[model samples]
Target: MTMPGRTRTKVCGLTNADDVAAAVDAGADALGFIVDVPVDTPREISPERAATLVGAVPPFVSTVLVTMAPIESIPALHERVGTDAVQVHGDVDVGAIDRLAGDCDAALVKTVDAAKPESARAYADAADALLVDSTDESGAGGTGRTHDWTATHDLAASLDVPVILAGGLTPANVAEAVGAVDPYAVDVASGVESEGGVKDHDAVRAFVSNAAGASADGAEVSA
Candidate 1:
């Protein structure tokens, strides 16, 4: 199968099997399933449901559990959800990242809020990848708002691992976002949704297509 050049795409907040299948068929490199969180998002799914969703995914497409559960609950959560990765967010501490990394076999993804840009630098080396997100008053991610990409540009340049840019990304503006931040990957939830927790298939196709084209352009320029 032909793929996008280098930049990866992850479709977050997927709820049902149809959306999951659509995302994978539309060429998403990864899929995010929100679990064990305090704040209310229309997309949040229970560990059991997430596991069922993860089971249906075919090979090569990663399943990431976007969780805010306590550090101690991680291993069991991963065991229950059967996710390939766990994104640690909401009052995350460096120690939590260390513990999660040590205790779980799944890939570790750390979320750094735009409100705490300096925190990104601190967690840069801790996780497999850093997901840069916009912060709301509640401190939960998937805010569907954009951050200062200039700061992200600097952060991505300094990081040893890849950075996945999120927040307010849509098919219309993702290309501009990629040009500014030049992230290793881009994540979208609301950007491609037709409604809360429901993905618009056409939007998904356009988003992946645009992001891949931008990634290709970036590669040629660097080459």
Candidate 2:
């Protein structure tokens, strides 16, 4: 678990060994790999590739497989991906998460749509952490759009579980997001990427630095 007043950082959509290394070197506390996602998404990686990339992850730096696959397929995916955690996105229900919890050993991080704060508390209880993201037209994350920070702030304050703020966060706005939401962690995919799965190392560093600095300063940001 993350310590209070310290905001953790996760860099998602990593595809190769180089990207994984860059994310870790840039001070990413967690790394996310998109698996079994929509055909149109450039972030999607095969379970074989994910396993290899996840193997390179060092201790204390978590490896997360972000999947939208059905609950029944989770066991097979988890075994193949071999990650420390799994984040379920898209229109999944709490019962699916509950079933996943029983079958998988990896920690669960449930992504809640930014518009649905009312369902947060229930989702929080079912997963290790709750991630708030701006969903795309397909109802999946990585849309590169920001959500209502005020609602996110309220939800985070109310939940006992950690709230990881994600969606359209960049080095420029991470500080403000941290200040406004006061999340336990922040997740960035397109924000740190030069392209779909290609990460910009400098942007990764700046993002981690800014998030840490903002947490320490505790300067409230404008909505």
Candidate 3:
């Protein structure tokens, strides 16, 4: 499978098996399952459910689990769910992120709100990737608000690890995002949702198509 340049797409907040399949079919390079409980988003799936969804994914397609702060149970969770990558959010320390990656043996992604560039950078050494998201009062992801992409772009340039840009991304604006930030990946949830956790298939396809177009253009420019 040819890896996309510029911005590979990650369809996040997937719940049902059908949605998972749809996301893959729609050309998502990765799928994100929310493990953060008591959240409003539709993507929150139980460990057993997540395992089932993960199993359905084909080779080269990544399955990512998103968790909240205080990553105490991540080791066991990672072992049980068998996810390709783990993303931790909320008020998590850099040391906790390091331990989670080392102990759990899963690729780590440390997420920081776009407002907090310094905090996000603090975990740059620990995490395999950085996810820049919008600040939310609920502490759960999938909010439609956009962060400062300019700041995120600067952050991505400074970091050695890959940066996954999130927050308020849609088919219309994703091309501009790729041109600006040049992220390794772009994760979206509410932007493609018909309602909260439920994904609209057409939206998903459009997002993937737009992102692919942007990636192709970026590659041309680089070449």
- Cα error of candidate 1 at position 181, Å: 0.7
Q: In model 2, which residue pairs have backbone atoms overlapping below 3 Å?
A: none
Please write out the lDDT profile of model 3 over residues 1-223, one tens digit for every residue: 1223446899988888878889999989999988755555556778888888899999999988887735888878877778899988787778877777778877898888888789877988999888888858655556777777777878888878888888899988887787777788888998888887798889999998877677523532332
* Alpha-carbon deviation at 130 in model 3, angstroms: 0.4
Q: What digit string (tens of lDDT, one per residue) describes model 2 on residues 177-215?
A: 988888999999999888877888999999988887785
TM-score of each: 0.93, 0.94, 0.91
Taking the candidates one at a time, how many backbone clashes does each contain?
A: 0, 0, 1
Worst ten in a row by lDDT for model 2 = 214-223
lDDT of 3 at 130: 82
Which sections of candidate 2 miss by over 4 Å? 1-3, 220-223
Better of 1 and 2 by lDDT: 2
Give the C-alpha miss distance for residue 114 in model 3, angstroms: 0.4
- Give the distance in Å from residue 79's predicted Cα in candidate 1 to where it truly belongs: 0.7
lDDT agreement with native, every candidate: 0.86, 0.87, 0.80
